[model samples]
Target: MQPGIIRLSGLFFLLIGSALVLSSFGRVDNAEKDFSPEQPCEWVFKISDKSLALFQDKLLDLAFETASSIPMNPHIKDRSRAQETVVLACLHLDCPKRALRYMDQIVDWRRGSCYADLAFYFARRDCIDDARRCIQIASQISESAEDWRRDRIRVKIAQTYVWLGQNQQVDEFEAGVVDSELGKVARVKAMRSDADAFHEQMQVLETRMESGNFDIMNNTLQAYTELFHRFYSDVQKRSLVEEKIKTAWNGMPISTRIERLTDLAEFALEHSDSDKALALVNDAQSLIDGRQWPLEHFIPMMGKLAALRFRTGDRQKARSEADAARVLFHAQKDTIVNIWKAGTLRPLAQAYQTMEDPDAALSLYKQALAAGIENPNSRPRAEDLTATCLSMALYAVEPDDDLWGQAHRIYQGLDHPW
Candidate 1:
């Protein structure tokens, strides 16, 4: 209300808290919706908090009631389920800050269980210190530390920081280089050393990939992709990376080899080096066929291959490969597949659209949107979901369904940090 108000943002919170609920509810014209898991929670996944504000008070009441009823539990699963109810409800109320308040009162869900969630919300609100605090708490806690999902979240968070650090390093280095004549001389020497440094980094990444930790390999590959671009600061440095990448792939495990090749193939495709991309894709195929990768991995690799074939005017083979990928994906249990289910469909749909098959493309887009809607943790791939959802929303202008609303929810998720 007043300038220079104290209370560590209490007044500010009150104003924001009140306005968002009013603004959100007022903007929407939906009838009173039922508040339950099957409908309400799924609604949270489909609609933005701004659109859910009409149920704000009801959601907070249910959230508090749910958390209070569970008090404590010996089983982490039960406690987790209870906390999830509160979190989901708070999300709908447009009060993630309030969500953390309830999360803190639980007093039994361990520590890190809520830290990651809190860090994400606080980061979105631009409360850097609070987000950093949650990250510290998350790292220090051991509860559910062994869960693969938690580890994946940690790796993702760590990568964000590393990315920012790398960008800062590059900016500083470039600024120093441009500051003086001596800096120009230093850049010449630094470029030579960077080539050697790039090779060394690739070796480390190769070793990590060979260690057989798929998650680690994924993260390392992400970093390698960024660092390779950065280290190759000159034409000479850029030319040096390709040979080292080739050497590193030599005799590596088939999975690692395929990963390297897939990366290079994608890079070449983006750079319009069609021959290089096709050659690498060919090399990756034999390895892919030899290994039994999950649908999550296999579908993307196959889809990329099909797209390359499509580009080369091999329409027959492209359609065949796309059909094979769809069949294999349909066979996968939902518990094992995630966003990749929808992700692979988008590109295939694009290819169909390019081939003058709008009906086929629309069907695939619908399939992709459904897959995204079904996946509970679809926010990790909010980008892809939003793209596919946009296509679906545009294609289906039916009054009975709300594809546009679904697309809006995904776009909101994209606005938040993963």
Candidate 2:
């Protein structure tokens, strides 16, 4: 791994960084938003990075016991885990729609982790109402809105610049192409060599960010985020990004390292350097874990890991990572600031399709599509995703199921969904 590898979130719900959650953000339900758990909640990653996997695994085991109505073995821990066992048991026993009822079991829903987990569960199923409720409950326990807004604005802007650099649009240098189309091809190379030529303009706009031209800042940010992601993922094909450009990137404030490290991670993958991808991802997770950022921030990274694991033939690990990606994508279903590249979901979706879970693959494809729409500059990309998803649906879905009709509808109704 290179210097300044990003540290990802320790929690694996899973994509916070790069399945950069294939992310969705929406309001939580209010009716069942408040509840009290047997004890105050604690984040699982804070306890063990493996805790989430264990929770799900143990839940399945506990389900068998619950089905037979057997007592769970005694194990010392927090009441939250036991409560989660029961709640998941409830959902397992045909009460998926009654997720809210289980929410009532938690004491002070905002102060506990169960509500959040449940919210994530509902989100995976696109149970927006229940997910929203869980989100509301979790929000109640977080930093005050004023403080969060302030920090988010600061973080969002840094993220914007980092993304711009990664998505820089420039063709690779080719002497022959330049000779053939002097002005056009050579100009493209010039742009690549002077990638930061926009720095002066960016500085001007960045200044206005504090002055409250948020729309301009956000719109500009969206445009640049897409560009930077593109540039970083494809950079390995070239010899060097300008040295000054590299210096500025490496010299960026630590606060902005999340996006930079993430792009580098993708860049590593694009170069077929799985070892580097793994190293960079682990480093980024360390950073993410240290920051205690929201779970959404972890998604893309986990998704990246999922892709890596799948490539390395660790099917179980890949499945676990992909599952985490799916959960986070649904749970953190809001937030326009994505640190991961677009198309990050394709591999995971393809993995699922390979595993014969067309439904899961289709969902991920749609999630990626939704994420792609956040940037107006990535419309072509959005179309790429659409085309990919449509093709997947057409080929992967079994004709016997009603999925073909649904796929046909999607192909007709939507612009693009990969």
**By lDDT, who's the top model here?**
1
Per-residue CA lDDT of model 2 for 185-278, tens digit only, reads 2111222333455454334434433433333333333223323433444454122332222333333434344444454555555567777566
lDDT of 1 by residue, 38-78 (tens): 22111121112343333334334432443344213222333
- Collision pairs in model 1: none
Alpha-carbon local distance difference test for all models:
0.46, 0.39
Per-model TM-score on C-alpha atoms = 0.42, 0.31
Highest TM-score among the candidates is held by which one? 1
